[model samples]
Target: MRRYGPAVLLLLTGAAILRISLLSELYLRYVQAGLRPYLVVSGFLLVLLGVAAAVAGRREQEPHGAHGGHHAPRIAWLLALPALALLLFPPPALGSYSAGREAAQRAAQGVGAFPALPAGGPVALTLAEFSSRAIYDSGRSLTGRTVRLTGFVTRDDDGTWYVTRLLVSCCAADATTNKVEIRGADAPPADAWVTVTGTWHPKGSLGTDGAWPPVLDAASVRRVAQPANPYERR
Candidate 1:
């Protein structure tokens, strides 16, 4: 039992992170939806490890001997830190602070041609999808189509305004941003979520290795609540 004390702490620590990730949607801040299965499996494995260690320790008991000497107390105490931090203060989702530091990462197109847009006046698309077409497809597919996009606002010191969203390759640490330069309206306050209706501005051009985000000739802008899933996974 005593030999497995640290294992128990490890189990709780892993489980606590998983619990917060699932129940509180804290996982959204750190990883893609695809990783949920791996996280679940890992949490269960930690619990099983602790249970096995506890059972084995019980069977190996020396009636008069201490299961674990005092030296291990510090290790067990240290193992509890992450678990305690998770319980006390859940980590905040990536916000303006993170978004502000990111660079322009929009592309002209993705791997292949975009699927046909709805046969109508305008097609609503994600900031990522719109930017991809703007940068990669040579303005062929989106030459005259109107697009509606929803994302948070970001304004530069030079007065440039952008409708922006984050795209995470794997985790927050690996997050890239998708931004559409709003051509007309004065940008709202930073991080204010909004939906914009716009046309692609061809002047943005086929993106070079490090070109800035394409521009959108915005027709209208509407305020919206921030979405539950803020990052686009690719």
Candidate 2:
């Protein structure tokens, strides 16, 4: 058991990541929906490697010396660091702190027309889609259209505020913000979820390299609890 400590620890680590990713929040901080299969495969592989190592380690008997000191190869110990850290401090889903620390914006979406809103009342759009229209399409798609948008509040040092969401290309490491300047009311507290009903600000400008997220002339803002699925794909 002593010699197999590292191997057993690894098995636990892989199992934890696998279990949490499927049954809890672990998947939110890393990878898009498409990468779920890869994560599953990797977790299984890690578990297999760990089990194999444990079996092999158990069969080996290190020669004991007269000095009465136990010596065993500890190379596998390094693998536990990441697993331990994860167990102690699981990575959180992206939100205000992430938004605040990340670059204010990222590459603008490709300049092209957006698909027409679905037929109904005010169309609902994810923050990424709304931001693309606001930034790359010059708000043409949003002009004169009342829409519903939902995200958490984030504020600038200057007291300007935004309705913001994050898009994860692969994982939190590459996540980027989709933000819209909020006008016509005070922004709810940072990280507070809200649904905004609004039209695009007629005077909004499309900006360079996504530097300027477009403005929304909010008609109403309603605070809500965070949704179970907090992040969405681009």
Q: Please name the candidate that would achieve the greatest lDDT relative to the true structure.
A: 2
lDDT tens digits by residue: candidate 1, 130-208:
7677667643688788889898888878989888888888888888777878998878888898989888887544656
Root-mean-square deviation of candidate 1: 3.8
Model 2, position 11: C-alpha lDDT score: 87
Candidate 2: residue 47 Cα off by (Å): 2.1
lDDT of 2 by residue, 1-234 (tens): 566876877787878678656656567666666677777787788789889989989899966663442354355566677787776677666889988887766454566677777676588888877777777674377777888899999998899999988877667677778788889999789999999999987443455543367788889999987775577765
Q: Give one clash count per candidate, in the order shown.
A: 4, 0
TM-score of each: 0.76, 0.81
Give Cα distance to truth, residue 224, candidate 1, Å. 3.0
**Global lDDT of model 1:** 0.75
Q: Which stretches of candidate 1 lie over 4 Å from their true place?
A: 1-5, 21-24, 51-72, 106-116, 209-211
Every model's Cα RMSD, please? Answer: 3.8, 3.3
